[model samples]
Target: MKLVIIDYGAGNIKSIQFAFNRLGYEAILSKNPEEIKTADKVIFPGVGEASSAMKMLKESGLDTLIPTLKQPVLGICLGMQLMCLHTEEGDTKGLGIFQTKVKRFSQNVKVPQMGWNVIKELKSDLFKGIKENEYMYLVHSYYAEHCDETIAATDYEINYASALQHENFYGTQFHPEKSGNEGAKILQNFLTL
Candidate 1:
């Protein structure tokens, strides 16, 4: 399969590429529109500030291209946050693939809820072989709020959408590449889709 990982000067691209490699697929990282559009599957992985990321996507014309993707597209971490309607991180507007907004974690709890957290209320093929309450590695201060697109939910300081799906688009607030076996299974499910 022609798997393309959208590269827009974000962190964690290598780890995602390596994770796919471990699954026996050679995934390419590219910012070219044609390369991204023609891929059998696309992975949008990001780890950085939302405003800068959105700026990069807009500059590269990817902000317009990503929403029109026909094939399955997976957005990880900041990539997922960018798929929503808007984000509180930088008062940035998102692609709006999922009709939701990303908000900052409450101040009552430590910001950037990091480490393994259980994801439950699974509702999509993304969790086909994975059981409910499976732990996924997360590292972010902003999160997608619960919405109709939320397929999986998690709790930190408050209940939030851990994963979301809308049509062919899928997103994960956690870093599946760093989530180990369960994470690998989730990626495998996405690849099969």
Candidate 2:
């Protein structure tokens, strides 16, 4: 199957590509909408600030194109945050695929909750074979609020949506590419979808 990673100038793209490489699947990177539209699977990734990332998506018309994709699409990190209805970071509007909001963690917790965190209450085929409370790599300050779309939840200062799914769209606030074995399984599940 043709796999495409949207390279809209914002993401830990090389690492994601390498992750797929290790899975024995070649992932193509492109900013062209037509190429992305034709792919069997698409990955929307981001690693930088929110508003700026949204701007880049808008510039490429991906902001509009992403939500309409019929094939399975996975959004990672800021890409997942951007898939929500809105984000506290930069007061930016998102792709609105997840039907939730992204809020900043209070000062009571570490700013960027870095390192491995357990994700529980797993739902969706994306987590198939993945046990509950499995650890996944995470690094972020903003988080998606719990909502009907939330397929997996995690705790830092409080419980928050770690993974979301809506029809063909799937998103993970954690970086599966960086999360090791189980993470690879999640990506592999997405590939099967």
Candidate 3:
């Protein structure tokens, strides 16, 4: 199956590419709308600030294209935050694929919740072979709040949505590409879908 990784210039494209490579699939990194539209599956991975990332997507016209995708689309980390309606990071508006909102973590624990954290209350085929409370790698100062689309939840300083699903759209607040074996399983699940 053809897989396209949306390269809006804000994602960790190489690591994502490598992860898919390990899964025995060659994923193309492209900013072209035509290529993205025709792919069987799409990955929207990002590792940057929300506002700047949104700027890039808008400039590439992907901001408009992404929300209308009929194929299964997976958004990772900052990419997931951008799928929400809005983000507190710079008061930015997102692609609105999900009705939730992203907000900065309270100062109670730490600014960015780094390292491994277990994701619980798993839902969707995205966690088919994955078990509940499986550790996923995460590094973010902001999180998508629990909403109707929330498929999995995690707790750090506060309880938040770790993963979300709205029809064909799937998003993970953690980096499945960086989560090792379990991460690979998640990506494979997306591919099989």
Candidate 4:
């Protein structure tokens, strides 16, 4: 199957490419609008500042094209944050694929919530075979607030939506490609979807 990984100068991209490669799927990294339009599956992965990332996407015209994709699309980490309606970070506006908003984790808990975290109350095709409360790798300072689109929840100092799904669009606050075996399964499930 053809999987397109939208490249807009974000980090951790090669790792994701490697993850897909191990699964016998070589994800194409491109910024061409036409290539993205025809891909079977799309992965919008990013790690960086919100405004800058959005700027890159907009400059490449992906900022507009992404939200219009008809196939199953997944956004990881900052990619997920960008899909929200808005974000507190950099006072940036998002693609509005999900109605919720992204906000910085409360100071009560350490920022960047880096490392392994367990996610429970799983829902949607993204978690089809993954067990509940499964440990997944995460490295983010911002999170999506509670909303109807939340498919999985995680707790740091407070419970927050860790994964979200709406129609053809899906998002994960955690990096499934780096989340180990269960994470791989999630990516595989996304491919099948």
Candidate 5:
């Protein structure tokens, strides 16, 4: 199957490509809209500032292209945050695929909760083989807030939507590609979709 990963000048494309390669899938990293639109599966992965990421996406036109996609689309980290309607990070605007906003975690807890964290309240196909309260890799300061589309929840300083699903659109705050075996399964499930 053809997997097109959006390379809007900011995504951590190599890790995602490595993940799919380990699964025996030849995933292509491309910024071309045609490739993205026609792919069997699409991954929107990123690791960077929201505003700068959005700026790059807008320049490439993927910001407008992604939300309208009919096939399965997965966003990781900043890509997931960009799928939301807005973000307090840099006061940025997002693709609005999910009606949620990204915000900074409460100051009481550590910023950028980097490392493995448990994700529970699983309720979608994305978590098909994943167990409840299973640990996943995370590294972020901003998070998507509670929303109807939220399928998996995680708790750090506060409970928030760690993963979201709405129709063919899917997103994860944690790095499934970096989360090991269970994380690999999640990516496999996404590919199967």
Candidate 6:
């Protein structure tokens, strides 16, 4: 199956690539519109700030193409954040696929909640075989508010939307490629979808 990882020059892409390799699937990293449009599964991975990443997407014309994708599209971390309507970070607008808003964690909790965290309230086939409250690696400050599209929820400062699914589009605030065994299962499940 053709798996394409969107490479707009804003992510920790190598690890994601290696993760897929270990899973015995080749994830092609491409900014090309045609290559992405034809893929059976598309992985949108990002690891940087919002506005600039959106800029890169615009430069590649992916900003327009991504939302129109007919196949399953998975957004990771910043990729997921950008899939929302808007983010408080950089005061930027997002792709508007998910009807939610990204907000910064309060000053009470630490910024960039790094390390392992449990994701519960699973609601999609994406978590198929993945047990509830399973630990997944995460590193982000902004989170999408709970909405009708939320499939999984995680709590740091508050219970917020950690995973979201809107029809063919799926997103995870945590990095499945970095989350060990459970993470791998999630990626594998996505491929089956």
TM-scores across all candidates?
Answer: 0.99, 0.99, 0.99, 0.98, 0.98, 0.99
List model 5 lDDT by residue over 1-193, tens digit each: 8899899888678999999999999999899999999999999999989999999999988888998899999999999999999999899999989999999988888898999999999998888978999999999999899889999999988899999998999999999999999999999999878
Worst 10 residues of 2 by lDDT: 11-20
Model 4 residue 147 CA deviation (Å) reads 0.5
lDDT of 4 at 133: 85
Q: Name the candidate, 3 or 6, with the larger lDDT value.
A: 6
| Candidate 4 ranges beyond 4 A from true positions | none
Clashing residue pairs in candidate 2 are none
lDDT of 4 by residue, 105-124 (tens): 88888998999999999989
What Cα-based lDDT does every candidate model obtain? Answer: 0.95, 0.95, 0.94, 0.92, 0.93, 0.96
Candidate 1's C-alpha runs over 4 A off are none
- Evaluate residue 182 in candidate 5 and report its C-alpha lDDT on the 0 to 100 scale: 98
Clashes of 2: 0
Single out the weakest 10-residue window by summed lDDT for candidate 6. 11-20
Quote model 4's TM-score: 0.98
Candidate 6, residues 12-94, lDDT tens digits: the string is: 89999999999999989999999999999999999989999999999889999999999999999999999999999899999
TM-score of 3: 0.99
Per-residue accuracy of model 2 over 1-193 as CA lDDT, tens digit each: 8999999999679999999999999999999999999999999999999999999999989999999999999999999999999999999999889899999999999889999999999999999999999999999999999999999999999899999999999999998999999999999999998
Clash pairs detected, candidate 4: none
lDDT (C-alpha) at residue 58 in model 5: 91
After superposition of all CA atoms, the RMSD between model 2 and the true structure is 0.6
The alpha-carbon lDDT assigned to residue 36 of candidate 2 equals: 96
